[model samples]
Target: MHQLIASPHNGAFLVARPGARAGMRIPRALYEQVASIAESGAPLPPWLLEGARTAWDLDLAGLTMRDTVLVRPETGLGYGRATYEINKGCNFNCEHCYLAERRFEGLPWVGKARLLRLLRDAGVLWLQFTGGEPLIDRDFMDAYTFAHRSGMLIEILTNGSRLHRPEVIALLRELPPYKVTVSLYGATPDSFDSLTRRKGAFKLVERGLAAAREAGLPLELALIFTRHNAHEVDAMRAVADRYGAARTEYGTISPTYSGTPEPLAAQAPGFLDKTGVFQGCPAGHTFFHVDPHGLATMCKVGRENPVDLMAEGLDGLLRLPGIADAQMLRTGGCGGCQLSGTCRVCRPLAKAYQEAKAPLNTYCRHGNEEA
Candidate 1:
């Protein structure tokens, strides 16, 4: 599937296929040329033929495409979905959480309301509410309601611990999110508590999931596989099935957002399977991440440089110094490596390697081959 993404190098837009190692930069003139022909049901001109393969694998000659979202352009940014981390303080501190020590000292409710208005006006259609746990955020309901009323589809990324709260359940019942994803730390109390390092959190999650289902909210379950809970994969899926969860996903642990390597040691056996190619990343392009305190950057993983939303207004935050220059990192040895073919390490993950300086054998399947 082709996705329209803003070029990080410049504010210009690029049409990129999912998982493409590189994106072809399309000039504005070229886009208009293709669009004009597409609308008129006329064949592409001869000059356009030479650029077709390099620009994108488009059948320019046939020119049957219509209603191109890329051509419509939103705020001249081309962003469809935006994820906001409302809060960073989580009740259950999972041992392998990426945002272990990350903190959020952000705007107050009034300022947040303004930011929501800005996002709505800027044409952000799908808004994702995420955090240490969005359910526990003090102004979550307000933000959720505001985003929904602003004509944005809302999705919540949260652990189910607070889902059982009366007000939280009521909010879900009143204005349901597009979907709610509950991260299941473990299936059993002992394993769950061990992973979160919190006593009696498993019960809260159980109650929260039940409450979500009771509220007629669409539910999804994601089980994070670590050395602590790899054995519970099947059991967790069964539990999700019983709850009638719409989807269940299993993901392996990655380096912490703090740039620490400690959590990498807790990976499950064979976690680093040779998945696929190590295409750069789509951080600032397709979707951008905003941490609490409005530190908007490429993504949460390799948050090396962030543009302060408060300092640099969203008017052109994406084109600011730190942001506009931010690209999928190809740092150090990765610039020209023989193992590039099988390397699944992306820019953010590569930053983790630079931080720890630990050999990739511990975390990468391709790196293991070299070892």
Candidate 2:
């Protein structure tokens, strides 16, 4: 019998017969949704499934992974990726905002019960704190505290606006993998202010970055690639070099958001480089997101195959348009390429680019080219 067994704590499902793994197949609807919108109505082309199988590392003919290991964290991209919109609204507003309607909305939070259940059911080992700026959320501690309690690794993407706050400092002091990824627009205020369109951001970000490093938090100085800062790559690296153990990664911005999509460059089609395999992109399968509006999506962009989390629990979300069957969908740009699981191709920027493009054209995509 085929029954979908899911956990409230680890967001995954096991579909199998009594004891066999060879006959299992993830539902077909998953493929239909993620199969290029151009191919949505057509039969899935052969390359798609071949690529998906290759990316998922499934032995189509032999079933290399045992049925019992289907939901094991070690066996798959279990609890793959999650973007927690701690602070749903933004203040800097350079451009391309889907949440423009929420510009002045208060920083709401995910309930403690809901969050713990998400962590436990999704097996969400990797949690990303995002939003208007994760730092600005009143429940930043509440979210961080839950991640810590769940014993998951975490990374935070921020505009670097509030690192100086005492409570923000306290969370970093106690969290694990307390990675602070800052989107530095330029080396100085003149150019930086132009990108974020906010005054005094340059000084605040610099000081915030320093405070994070001094506290010994793992720091990744992220440079938002754009025509404006294209020439300042060296200066950006110089900033990274100062931090002995900190990293400096570079990436291009995507102009996919419907409003003011292009911050400093035009949109790139495919959003992905179309050159590598993410080795795995088991997003909706492992981890997923529930936006402020209570929509549950695989990633942050919230456009593709979005399942309203409020209407449906985790199990129902997986059955939505884009994720019905877990195994049949392609991991998009990184599904069948050589990089496989080592690339960060399914990031928020990538998602935005795919959904529209502005966020990607103006964000970072470097670090761990492999998974």
Candidate 3:
């Protein structure tokens, strides 16, 4: 398979570091899929290093990456869903962290400089930063600086603990974010802290949020419907009201994490409200997730090896991954299920169905359900 060992960036060859350990070996077929994304002949960085197979380096030029191997690109240019684990780890041990058990073990800080360069070079317009808690990133300014300079709009999905402090708040007002998506587990620090397993997280998060508002950044509130917090969602709304962020609005949790402790099955049939106007969960096809390991997939739901990203040059993320190719959650459970409105359909779980796996049956009854 053809591999571009390194691409020159800013007139400097970005060769893999001297001790660059080999990435998960990509199959020939998968490598071809990635090639199609870079068919436009976009000047690419040498992100891949090839192992000597058959004693020769395969030339990658003119090798079209197949569209079938990549995730579907977003319809409108200048706007697409982008999620990055900015910190590669989180400080809080939130009760629902799917990556919590493996948080500390993901890839180390890859430097915001390279991440933003890749995103800009790939033509990404909007970016979503998620983590166990992204505020804790020491090199966060570097990332913010790069994304802003590259004309990328930022959306921070944060826990709000860091934004509450007056000093942090003052600094936030000085360098306002384009938008903030705060995940509010509970309004009061007592409930929020208990749910997050951190004693003063609630207070810190709340204060950090006040700081963001005091700075006038547009803010959106994301409420995950869990048994522990569903009972007081209105209180969470009250927290939003205090910020005068009426223009910003609501969000839902993903049902894929229901395997944990949530009583949605007993609370309501669906976590989504019928009046809501959002379409089905279309993340994988519309958004891409690159793990700290650099394994690119259609969305955060996926748990498979390099899907079609190697050959694609990071731009062909617009096509859909084939049904048989995904290692994800079940489909019978979500193929035609009724929870689209409540739970953000887990692409990983949906991959299960696309690949003909057994339905991992689950029932979440959080909030009010129509049927």
lDDT of 1 by residue, 1-371 (tens): 11222222235535432223244566777666654554453554555444445656655455433422223333655555678988888887787777757454567998788777766655566678988887777788889888765555567888888888898888766666667888887789988999888999999889988888888788888877778878888888887887889665545556676567667766787655455666555567656777777777777675667767666667555563345335464657577766766777676666675666656665555644753
Candidate 1 clash pair list: none
Across residues 1-371, which tens digit of lDDT does each residue of candidate 3 receive? 12322222222222211112222334444444444454553433233313322223433343433311122222232224467776556767666554524354444445346555556555454577777577677766566655654444566778777766565455444444557778777777676776677888777776767667767767777765555566677877787788766433232333332133332222222344333333344455545666554455656656454444434545544444442234334344455656555653344644433343322333233234345
Ranking by TM-score: 1, 2, 3
Q: Which candidate's lDDT is highest?
A: 1
What TM-score does candidate 1 get on C-alpha atoms?
0.75
Residue 26, model 2: lDDT of 41
| TM-score for all models, in order of appearance | 0.75, 0.61, 0.60
In model 3, state the lDDT of residue 141: 57
TM-score of 3: 0.60
Q: Count of backbone clashes for each model?
A: 0, 38, 31
Across 187-291, the per-residue lDDT of candidate 2 in tens digits comes to 778777777778888888877877777877777777654445556768877877775335544444444433334443422232333335344545566567656
